[model samples]
Target: MSSLVQIKDVTKTFHRGSEDVPVLSGLNLTVAKGEFLALMGPSGSGKSTLLNLIGGLDRPTKGSVSIGDDRVDQLSERALAAWRARHVGFVFQFYNLMPVLTALRNVELPLLLTHLNKAQRREHAETALKVVGLSHRLKHYPRTLSGGEQQRVGIARAIVTDPTILLCDEPTGDLDRKSGDEILTLLQTLNQEQGKTIIMVTHDPHASARATRTVHLDKGQLSTAQPE
Candidate 1:
């Protein structure tokens, strides 16, 4: 498969007071289309930072971040926002669903940024929820759901936009073993059956095992990719 995401000699730094704190330095990596890749490392290893760059959430201090044909690091702020809405979906460790919104409504949030009508958004949201096996909980609130169920809702919301890639940050970190396994299974199904390219940051070996390939990061540099 062709390379879908490329990071070339990328570096990220933050200015803390008068000090320049570097997070990533000369990092180079590539992810192919339809790949389910896992990034693992100890805390503060720049895994999440790399994910953010790939998703166009942040730019590198030096070098390039390319997703397909777009040079993400070079996009204007407004352009990057639009690009992300169309091409990237994010899942966080903590479910970011709205407390007051119904499950279906929360899944429809991404569509609101598009030109889809209310009915169209609702249809797409329902389809996404159904895919995640949460159709029965369409009217439920986030607070009413279990940790696993809420994460399912988060997965549904992430994919509702049909983005080109999924960027997951510790997606199952908050759930129990059974629930985490279920979520991992769902992700595997999505990768194998739906051909969705996934780049996930995980601390759990079990969670990383679900991916097709795994790579390690240490202090901003990546280790070689290993078959899962």
Candidate 2:
């Protein structure tokens, strides 16, 4: 498969009260189309930072981040926001669903930025919810749902726009083992059957096992060996 996401000699730094904190140092990575990649590391190893760089939520201090034909590291904030809405879907550890909105409305939130009208948005949201096996919960609010169901709603919201890439940050962290496995299976189906490329950051070995490939991060660099 051809490369869909590429990171070349990327470095990221943050400033804290006259002090510079280096997160990633000359890191390089390539994710192929339809690939399911798991990023594993200890806390503060820059896994989430790397994901942010790829998703255009944050820019690298040096080097490049390329997704498809776009140079993500170079895009302006406005352009990046538009690009993200068009190509990237994000799944967070927390469901991040609004407590007041029904599952369908929460899923429709992202489409509000597009040209799609209310009916079109509803159609897209319904389809996405069905994809995540939540068609029956469309009218349910987040507070009324179980942990796993809420996460499914979150997944529905993420994929409503049919994003080119899914950037998941510990998607299963908040779920029970059974629920996590279910979510992982759903992700696998999306990757294998629908060909959605996914880059997930996970700490659980079980979660990493669900991915097609796993890479480790330490300090600020990448490695193949599992951390001890």
Query: Per-residue lDDT for 24-92 in model 1, tens only?
Result: 999999999999999999899999999999999989999999999999999999999999999999999
Highest lDDT model number: 2
TM-scores of the models, in the order given? 0.98, 0.99
Q: What is residue 227's positional error in candidate 1, in angstroms?
A: 15
- lDDT, candidate 2, residue 2? 99
Query: Which pairs of residues collide in candidate 1?
Result: none
Clashes of 2: 0
lDDT (0 to 1) per candidate = 0.94, 0.96
TM-score of 2: 0.99
TM-score, candidate number 1: 0.98
| Candidate 2 C-alpha RMSD relative to the actual structure | 0.7
Q: Which ten residues in a row have the lowest lDDT in candidate 1?
A: 219-228
Once fitted onto the true fold, the runs of candidate 2 whose alpha carbons sit more than 4 angstroms away are none
Taking the tens digit of each residue's C-alpha lDDT, what string does model 2 give over 1-228? Answer: 999999999999999999999999999999999999999999999999999999999999999999999999889999999999999999999989999899999999999999999899999999999999999999999999999999899888888999999999999999999999999999999999999999999999999999999999999899999877
For candidate 2, the 10 contiguous residues with the lowest summed lDDT are: 150-159
